[model samples]
Target: MTLSDETPGGAGMHVHRLLDEAFAGVEMGPDQQDLKEEMRGNLVARVTELTATGMAEPAAARRALDELGDVRAILDATESRPGPGEAAWQPPRVRPNPAFAVRTVVLSAVAATGLLVLVLAATVVDVPLAAQIVAVAFVALAAGAITADALRQETTTNHPVPPARAAGYGTATLLATTGLGAAWLYLRDAGLPWLVAGALLVVASAVLFTYLGATQTNRHKAWVLRQQAPYGSDRFTEDPAAAARFGIYTVTVWLVAAAAFVALTLTAGWEWSWLAVVGGFVAMTVLIARMLFAPKA
Candidate 1:
């Protein structure tokens, strides 16, 4: 009748399948994930003891699951608003990681210094091969660390930043490096001298900041939604309304950029019309930055 607690039975995998089936459409959070593990471990232990006591493996598993009863009912009763005997466990508050900040700051400083050296090399032609190599190494390491840290955690109990978004930030980091490098080299040939290179570098930096800031802001908002939502769920922005708004915002930005390009070409001629693209980018960057840092009241 009683089950042992030494180890899980061979029926462990089956029990997992059962649990997954029972909670198939359920939205899971960090605490819920933990509870799933707890239930799986406990049930398998019970089944193992039952089998040891001469019960068939399948029969013991069924018996244990029967004891488990309704999955939704159990989770609903336990996740939040715990009973008198249990302690409350909510998601922890977000805090800045000092090491992560250091990596970000170092990456920025290295990029600036490297660009300055590249600019200087245009005139001197002797920027030292060893220094260039060291600059490249530093950029790679610092950028990698900052990107990794962004996706590492949101709070103690939650993986708040979605994996999809994390992958995006990482991809942007790689593209940022390439874009800045290419723009620098291209402007050198375009003959605006140092100003063009500096402007391109500034644009690259702005774009990088916009991607990181906008995505991180969205991730935090999602976490807030999950914390306040009901039914043992942590899903966010899963509706058509949110999608529509995002679509509109995207379309509007591109429309403005295109309009700027045509207007500048007509008014200022071809030589300087390309600056419209840069102007539109700066405007969009300012908009995103404002939204990202807006008051959270």
Candidate 2:
């Protein structure tokens, strides 16, 4: 099986890249797809076998590939090879990123709580303890739902979204907001202001979720870009030094942000320290943009 460097992770990609180098000056024919699939299958099979013996997957894949010798040599040797049946191969799936899932839960919980508090305070101006408890429960439910979605997105980046599933989520959100709207219109005993606040909260949460989905989708775009960028393309211009410079810039920006966060906490109290972080993020984004778009020297 041909390893594809275009893939996000592993020695499969490394082997694929080496093959690409060997393919230089060779005309790609109709069998290109078959060759790629065959190569990938063989390499992955070897990796799986090695990992079965307790080798780490990455190291096993690497070792198995290295033992196979050069990509071009393997390709030539396998020129007359027939691939295994379709049942023997399948595409890899991305696992949910645990760190991202935890972050999402924390952030969603905070945002959900904020929205609930906003709605409760605006509607009643002074909510009773029981009312606040009910609001917190509702917010907790919303937070749970949002976190589930964010965890789902961790895997979504590795594959295309199913249209029916997308429709299901869209319909669910629409129905929820519509029900809230209907209550706002018909339930006069439930103060119009309170119902309206609830509806608005639903709408705001939906928008926030849309933003999160967009962010995850953008990650896939980055993977696509990396895959498309040829290793030898402007090699001198995109060398280790350039990467090191950007790495340094990133480190420096975050360090400055941390320092600012600490300084503001000391001088202006903890409440204002977060704003310093917000400013740092903006500044760092601008700096990175400038660096990326700067005229080549």
Candidate with top lDDT is: 1
Query: Which residue runs of candidate 1 sit more than 4 Å off their true CA positions?
Result: 1-130, 157-164, 170-198, 211-227, 230-297
Model 1 local distance difference test score: 0.60
Clashes of 1: 0
For 261-285, candidate 1 gives per-residue lDDT tens digits of 8988999898878887887688678
lDDT of 2 by residue, 1-297 (tens): 545334344544554555455565556664554455455556666876887888776567567667766656545554545363332322334667787677777756765775567476558777554554455545544545553454346452344344444444544454454445435333535556666666766776576555434333232422333444434344223443554466567768889889999999999999999987898789888976776656666
Q: What is the TM-score of each candidate against the true structure?
A: 0.34, 0.33
Record all residue pairs in model 2 with backbone atoms less than 3 Å apart, i.e. clashing.
1-38, 1-39, 1-40, 1-41, 1-42, 2-39, 2-40, 4-13, 5-13
Which 10 residues in a row give candidate 2 its minimum summed lDDT?
214-223
**Steric clashes per prediction:** 0, 9
Off by over 4 Å in 2: 1-17, 21-66, 69-89, 93-150, 153-191, 210-226, 229-291, 294-297
Q: Which candidate achieves the best TM-score against the true structure?
A: 1
